[model samples]
Target: MLMTTNEPQSILDRSGMTNAEAGALYRLLTWLSPSFPVGAFAYSSGIEWAVEAGDISDAVSLRGWLAALLADGSGFCDGVFLAQAHRAAETGDDGVLREIAELAAAYVPSRERQLETTTQGRAFIEIARAAWSYDGLDLLIASCGGTIVYPVAVGIVSAAHGIPLAPTLHAFLHALASNWISAGSRLVPLGQTDSQRVLASLEPVVAATAGRALLATLDDLGSATFRADLSSLRHETQYTRLFRS
Candidate 1:
């Protein structure tokens, strides 16, 4: 469990991470990387529609949009699922894992959103098992009934691989924000430099999101970014589009 702010730091805090932690960190980087073959590039998670609707047209607006997503929208909700899945996996509680996986799958606001998350989730699991096979990976797979959502897929694998929750949660949210920024760069036609700038500006939002998720339970899972969800819902019938969601 996470410690409260009033408590002192654990003596286990070290000046340098151990070899095992170093390895786990490397795995997280690889798994969440844009080139991970999860086909994450094929979906924009509704950023395509937002750009078309002028909700995001420049670096400034894109930054603000992503900040909200990472804080009060699907980003935070996914982080909560990820953290919960991680805990369930760590404790070998398939019952809670099943509930989380199903809830995450059903939580999408649109068909495309559901398609975006579950398709990538399925691919994520298949690839991870192929390259980094672990015995415990199937625990959540069985629980989700083959319809795993992306963040929960990642959380389960991360825990089974011995990755600690804090860094894994941080990396997951960072990758999420990064992917949305990538979609915005293409849709808004922003310069690569500006895209990097927008991502850099979101570091704090990502950090705070992961921190809250680390302490959150299922009761805290919800989204308030109505526009973002509406964009996703309306994208289904959009006249023109370049993304799958």
Candidate 2:
């Protein structure tokens, strides 16, 4: 979606950006920073359920679960949606963007998964509007007639702000993986050292998944994390749960 090449080009100079590249980097940091008010801490994406079910009881199990998730599950599906939405926003194709938004909202396999995306998406939009307003962003918002998903909302905003696609997608996937790792840390009762180790081990997988997502299309969107999907559905009625999803 974003016109990109393996060759390294100075985005600051190539895009005619008046500010230094540091400004763009800072924007990405702030937007994706853990302190950002998307309420990501409230949802576990079914990791809590997985923990309770003993599917993720240790660092090794957690890492494997997250790897599968990043490689072929919601992570892959969301990446395709984000890339498509970003392309639509970049091209000023409101119709395509709207269609993508609706499709993304409907793509989730369970009710909690739906809430997980839509709630965070609504929060992300509202906070971004108040903190970093832009003409292109406002246009995208006006065109989204129904509920928006988190990845689609983020894609539209990132594109509107002139952020490059590959790094944006990579950062997004990394952030999600980190969040899941954090959830696993708490749910698994792993120490900080073990948590960091798990995160470190997942770097290669994260890179591989990001590279795959960059070249993936909407037709490639599908989930093979059968247990993960079942876990999310099971979490709906889970007793004594620690996460919202």
Candidate 3:
């Protein structure tokens, strides 16, 4: 007797679906999508300068820079703002949200990094409102008088999507690290396998950073001043470059 083949079903198909689950999945995919209009592809966040300066000319150096960045600087700052924004949105407190937005805007040290956060933020808000119709998100967008910062947008969208703040913050940092690794792989001529290794090396850092972010307050948004700020400013006048910043 010949047995008939029974192909396994996808997890999505196997687990019975709910509207909430579908909505959450949709929001996660949309937020993480490269085409989400966050403009993440355009900015290199000063890694370009590190490459040009011979400081990050190899995978090892690039990984070190990225690790310091995520653990100590913009990554940590953004996570704090994201958590604050989430709380403000949850409470329907526009005043708190506005304050958080202003703080995030002022947190960046260089012109390029400043433009990077706010420009992509404003763009993300527009795309988010267009793509996902959430009432709270609409309210938040309408409240923004000018450019919104990236962390603000992340918080609002994460709340709208029903994702917890900690995991959302973790994913944001992970994506940032990965983006830098990809840029480094090209700029430094690192092999794809080496790039993967660099990213894998960041898993523990990401977890520790997220844990730290959870306990972080608004007052804890300090960064490593010299390298981070100087690199970003120097990138502005770099005679030749592959990245915008």
Candidate 4:
């Protein structure tokens, strides 16, 4: 039997490839920056509903809710969408990209969720195009023919900029989880330290999820019955809500 190493040792060994290292850093910083203007702060992704419903009123429930969402719902959906978008962009198929965008757009069950995906997605693409100046990115923007979904924009920009899918997707998932956790902290009135502890506990989930998502295909884009969707739907009618979605 023979064993093989899958590491990019050759690429890591090159000292003159500072551009590659810088590019990765830049992408990471941009994706994680609170100022990226993805409108992530405005939408709680149904967390507000969960909090109001008392489903996630404490740190324990908050952690559990977030974990389930990341493991079974949006995390999986986004992973598949990201991969499909990457493949579409790689092939330079505008139709495929549009289809991918539509599929992602339709996956969200609630109107609020749909709005969040499209709104953040369009902003993300516009910002990336204006700041990064990548080749295929412009084509993707034009091909959108309308507003692009968030996962699709992420996939396109990541692939166009030569960023690996795993890291980009992982960062996106982590940021999402972090945003929810931040919301939980505010809603549950959990201390800042407890929030950090909860986030630390999610590190393993993020790492394992990223590895799993790397192997995921379009066939794997399904959601579990988490009740969060129902919460989001109900949020649309909630009278005195602090968050948009």
Best by lDDT: 1
Decreasing TM-score order of the candidates = 1, 2, 3, 4
Worst 10 residues of 1 by lDDT: 6-15
Q: Write the per-residue lDDT of candidate 1 for residues 129-245, one digit (tens) a residue.
A: 899988867765787665899999998999889998898889899999999989999999999899999999999999999899888889988889999999999889999988999
Tell me, what's the RMSD of every candidate? 7.7, 6.8, 4.1, 6.8
Give residue 118's error in model 2 in angstroms.
0.6
lDDT of 2 by residue, 1-245 (tens): 79766343455567665464556567777777778889898899999999999999999999999999989899888888888888899999999889899999999988998999999899988887787788768889777778999999889888888888888888888888888988888899899999999889988988898888788887788889999999999999998988999
- C-alpha positional error of residue 14 in candidate 2 after TM-score superposition, expressed in Å: 18
Q: Across residues 9-75, which tens digit of lDDT does each residue of candidate 4 receive?
A: 5455564545586677677678667668888888888888888888987778888888888888887
| Residue 47 error, candidate 1, Å | 1.2
Over all chains combined, what TM-score does candidate 3 have? 0.89
Error of 2 at 6 (Å): 33
Report the Cα lDDT for candidate 1.
0.88
Clash numbers, per candidate: 0, 0, 0, 0
- Where's the lowest-lDDT run of ten residues in candidate 4? 6-15
Considering only N, C-alpha and C atoms within 3 Å, which residue pairs clash in candidate 2? none
Ranking by lDDT: 1, 2, 4, 3
Tell me the tens digit of each residue's lDDT in model 3 across 1-245: 98664433344456775557666766766676665667788788898888888889887888889888888888878888888887777777888788888878887888888888888787877777787777667787655445679888888777866777776787777877877787788888899999999999999988888889889888777887369678899999999987777
